[model samples]
Target: MSTTDDFDAEAWRAELEGYRDRKDEFFANERQSPIPADQRDAFDGLTYFDPDPAYRVEADVTPVESDETVVMETTVDTEQEYERVVELGFDVNGETATLVGYTGVGEDRDSLFVPFRDKTTGQQTYGAGRYMEFEVEGDVTEAETVTLDFNLAYHPFCAYNDAFACPLPPEENWLDVAVEAGERLPEV
Candidate 1:
């Protein structure tokens, strides 16, 4: 009998698999998803700010920005460090990708802001780039070796409708891999 606090990677994996199986239904029913009145008001008041100056990648790629960071909590066993807007660079299908994000802020102090897109846009994933949140180890000042996992990338609410104004991911955040995790767009 493992307690709730006991480590259970298999259970967590099973839960994620369930989400993947029902992603379509989850996204489709999101609009009708109910929330407490107070929570709804808070969600409504949330504003997403675009990155200023519009960071670019290649001549053909468009940049995206956002004010949200992926929230992750610190763990006792990891040597991870917290970082505020850590700078990271990678290559997506031979093209250069860059991302500047912060860590250690509000409630989820170990959170990370990773605004990114990939070559799969308009083909597999949402036409707009995806967002990912992760946990860091230490303070924001020491964020050089942060690990990024694409499996957590998710589409912004704006991707569902034009009525919402969402910031696009910067060109630098694009990933070359086909991230097969998280929510996918609802088929029209």
Candidate 2:
């Protein structure tokens, strides 16, 4: 993980701007997006908090050893199975927090699925939670470390429409402090 001294806030902001542009395009294009065709006319853009570098943290990541397949509850009544692969311990504000990173089966088994909630839920951000994905390769071991950038946290597709089924963050991933970065309360 990159230390604070090595973290480039300006570059991160540029990357985030690029992400926002792509997301805006995706939302505007009803043919390939979750936004209903009828509502495309009114779609402005996703709401987001100002880019704050303080929310980017370097976490001590440790891999979990278990044959466990957790039954993750989704937006709808249906539930899905996810493998809890790693635990990331970090600091937000003045408090310490830990979030679990999971992985899907088959093709996505190597991908990192980081879903979480903060004190901002339902008020300042998505009612359910936010998600972050790290396109990591190889298995996590004792020496693994990760960057937990809350500035990249995003709402699930379900936030845009009801037709989608998004997996909700487990109770363990909830943080007590307000994470004042990343995507804000999305207007649907």
Q: How many residue pairs clash (N, CA or C atoms closer than 3 angstroms) in each of the candidate models, in the order given?
A: 18, 0
Q: Global CA lDDT of candidate 1, please?
A: 0.48
Q: Write the per-residue lDDT of candidate 1 for residues 8-55, one digit (tens) a residue.
A: 556655664565446534443455423333344333321122211112
Tell me the spans in candidate 2 whose CA falls farther than 4 Å from its real position. Answer: 1-4, 186-188
Give one digit per residue, the lDDT tens place, for model 2 in 104-170: 8444545688899889999999898999988765665444677778888999989988999999898
The window of 10 residues in a row where model 2 has the poorest summed lDDT is 135-144
TM per model?
0.49, 0.92
State the displacement of the C-alpha of residue 126, model 2, in Å, after optimal TM-score superposition: 1.2
Give the Å shift of residue 102 in candidate 1.
4.2
Error of 1 at 20 (Å): 5.3
Task: Itemize residue pairs with steric clashes in candidate 2.
Answer: none
Q: Please state the error at residue 133 of candidate 2 in Å.
A: 0.8
